[model samples]
Target: MRTIGADSPQGIPSSLNTVDIFMSHEGLLLEYEQSLTRHLPSPTDPKGERKWYNTGAHFLWIGDRTRQPDGAHVEYMRGIENPIGVKVGPTTKPEDLPELLNRIDPKKEIGKITLITRYGAGNVEKYLPAHIEAVKESGHVVVWVCDPMHGNAKVAPSGVRTRHFADIITELSKTLRIHKDNGRKLNGVHFELTGDRVTECIGGSMELSDEDLSTNYQTYCDPRLNYEQSLDVAFLIAKYYANEREDMERNVFRL
Candidate 1:
């Protein structure tokens, strides 16, 4: 858990190498987003008029509950130039993917769309494969990312909302493996985390149990990973990719 110092060169903290950070949010508050929306001259059109962009954030995603094909959210998202994400949960129907893409990404624009899957650990094995196949069949270009936090949420006996680290890891690992086996790359991951030591979620390297949730619980909404827990997850993901690279190298050697 290294902290980036403000005095570091190029506006990057000393703890981290230079990196690009893009802002994102769930485009739920349409009014606020609409107010921030602005039109800028299109790069492809020197003579054409400006194009609409929700300058509020570089990227915005539609929640699973609001991605209706003819819904207002989809309509708003379709008209924006920013890349959009659609949350695909366990309830998502494989056959409906084409219709969803038809509404949001009619142009089949590369990198214009991302599908964030949030099937729980138990449901991921069953639902993700079919969803992957459906997207492949539709021939729609999309980046696939895993959102392990939302699906693995649970309420403790003490009536506190918490997510188990084990469940989160399980869901992420299964999602990645599923994508690899299906010949599609799992492009990225989304997580709710904080640098502060808040005991919002349980079960991390600290072995924080339900009893410890009362110590520093702070969130009014969804629980988030404390700094140590966030680092734990980052290390695990690094290990997964390292093993994957090792396997790829061995295969190439064999070839």
Candidate 2:
């Protein structure tokens, strides 16, 4: 529930209000500003346990770098009951997933685990199918969420690492298609976005270019979609899902 707008230190415009806009969509925006804390053992506790899951956050995830099966981060997350996710990058091996899934979701409970795919645009088509097949074959029910932004990142002419809007859409489309082909469903999308008018990402309906980025590129990490750009993405994703639902209904009617 952070305040949005140019009045805030983040330099986003009040009119954008991306947080409020998304909140209306029945989704929870779990905060991860201090995500590193999830890795460290509690300072005051003797057992050195991770305490972030107890703080009432709706969802928590371990980043790609910390998802190693033997790592403490995953070990800590394994015991938590909150819906959890792990970032899966291109280099992830299909053979390693059973161990990871076993560690995190030993019971294979529905909605308890999510696999967030971050394979880059070029590699997703090549690498994602194996992971999907592996997961399917294991009979583990996991929500598949696409992290298109991270995988599609490229260095813009301004030297900032940015993701192309078209590339983001392409990856999302491909992920949906892959999941459908595998007889699984793609449940969500993860994005790095702000409720500001900053010009960090290129393309979208605004036709933002490299030159526009110099105006207010304020992100410390990856480039995020600004308010308008974020809305554009949301609408596009909604359309994709709507079409999917429609197709499903049509197939049922035919049967």
Q: Give the TM-score of candidate 2.
A: 0.77
Candidate 2 has which clashing residue pairs, if any? 5-12, 6-12
204 in model 1: Cα distance from truth in Å? 1.4
Number of the predicted model whose lDDT against the real structure is largest: 1
**Clash statistics: count for each candidate:** 0, 2
Q: How far is candidate 1 from the true structure (C-alpha RMSD, Å)?
A: 3.9
Q: Give the whole-model CA lDDT for all candidates, comma-separated.
A: 0.93, 0.79
Best by TM-score: 1
Q: Kindly list the per-residue Cα lDDT of model 2 for residues 95-175, writing each as its tens digit.
A: 999899989888999878889999877788898899998888887999899989888888887688888888888888888
List ranges where model 2 is wrong by over 4 Å.
1-53, 252-255
* lDDT measured at residue 220 in model 1 versus the true structure, 0 to 100: 98
Clashing pairs in 1: none
